[model samples]
Target: MKRLLLSAALFVSITAFAQTYPKYTNEAGTPKSTSKPPAARLKSDGTEMRSETVMPSRITGDFQEIMERAVIQNKEHNYAAAISLYTQALNVANEEQAWRALVSRATTYQTMDKPNLDKAIRDLTTIIDAQNAPQKQLAYIYTCRGRILQEMGDIAGGCADALKAKELGLPVALMAGLEGCK
Candidate 1:
């Protein structure tokens, strides 16, 4: 009876050990794609295969493309290319799009090795003078123009703009730097 019990115990242990761990395989099996299927699929025999329908973009305009390319050129330090693209974008852009292009171009001008303060001021002023412009954008424009004014030795103008920006709820910590304001 003891030998019989031992044999049964050994059989149970072997069975448990065999089924304890899972089998791992290196095969990738069939590919599962989450993206919309290709518009056209070709089989090995060069025959077209049916695929899931894919939708094309509805946004058709050169303005967005020009703006995107201009931003890329600006980041790469190719100011001339960026400026040209921005100009093209402005020509094809609507009023709101034109505003964005102007602001971007003005910022790029300010960032150049030789800052174009005149053009920057003009761009900011245009935005400020636009009909129904947002107050927050106006505040930013005022602060930007004020900095340019101060740099160009117009202390009074700079101070006045700084005061305006402060009144518009923008933080103007640099007001102390405008010596002529007091």
Candidate 2:
């Protein structure tokens, strides 16, 4: 009789738990649409047209506000505040957005007194080396790393990074100080 009761209790508990959970559809629904709908090109009639479901501006505005605050702190030479804000942004940001914040914060560290220049260099270098990093982004990381090395008086290493930046097609102007070091 005790065994029968225990089995009933287990079955009831499992049923209750299962029913309380919401059903997930296809693992959060089919993968997000990658391709844009066909462009709404103007017809000869020239009637006005627009895409359906415009993205909300508030989402982008929030990210921009956070990034702007980080930039302002860096400009004011408040490295700690800038780094903190950048980290907050990174936590909520997409892949490209996070990379931008990390690169900016690394530069802020280089600009601070008694800066951990080696760590800054390493941070930028790792981002540059990322296999999936966007192509245009590699130049920016190399430029930042070069500046940190140049500031620390490692002319040879700085020049190498600067050259790498240039080879990646960044404008020569970004490597201004390292030009002579080359």
Candidate 3:
């Protein structure tokens, strides 16, 4: 089931699209994508290599509704609205759903113009403190935060995060090794 509403994007996608999209667009939300991001990625090789946000088949109810709306707002570049909805989703979401929303929010804040580095790290760190998501999920968050820290000139913090991500099996951290991350 899909519903479409237009708005601006802040951090993440909502819950109603069937197509999978790459993670985020620029702060301006150019080169628009028409689908929500997958909570998980394709962990296989060969012809199966592609990037997209895959929604589970069973998402339904109010949590789903909020997430879907948030996606719409995010895609439409209604960032403030998207953030509010994601926050609303938090109040209703279960443990797994909360993790998803937090990831979405953290990524959003990290990427938005005049990126909120502190808020982004705060959200990512909350997830880290929980340690509830699977290792791959944690690895992804680490890389996201690491990139933010690097951008903020916290090379040590960023490198630590990148190294942690690498330790958790995401080789992308190695690729994220900015100039001083040796």
* True-vs-predicted CA distance for residue 17, candidate 3, Å: 16
Using TM-score as the measure, the top candidate is 3
Tens-digit per-residue lDDT, 6-64, candidate 2 = 23432343243335433222233233321212345577799745432122231232445
| Candidate 1 lDDT (Cα, 0 to 1) | 0.58
Residue 93 lDDT, candidate 2, scale 0-100? 52
Q: Per-residue CA lDDT of candidate 3, range 112-158, in tens?
A: 65566676777777778777566776776776677667767797988
Q: How does each model score on lDDT?
A: 0.58, 0.56, 0.59
* Residue 60, model 2: Cα distance from true site in angstroms: 15
Task: Kindly report which residue pairs in candidate 1 clash with one another.
Answer: none
Error of 1 at 75 (Å): 0.8
Worst 10 residues of 1 by lDDT: 25-34
Q: Cα deviation of 90 in candidate 1 (Å)?
A: 1.6
> Where does candidate 2 clash, by residue pair?
none
Q: For residue 42, what is the lDDT in candidate 1?
A: 80
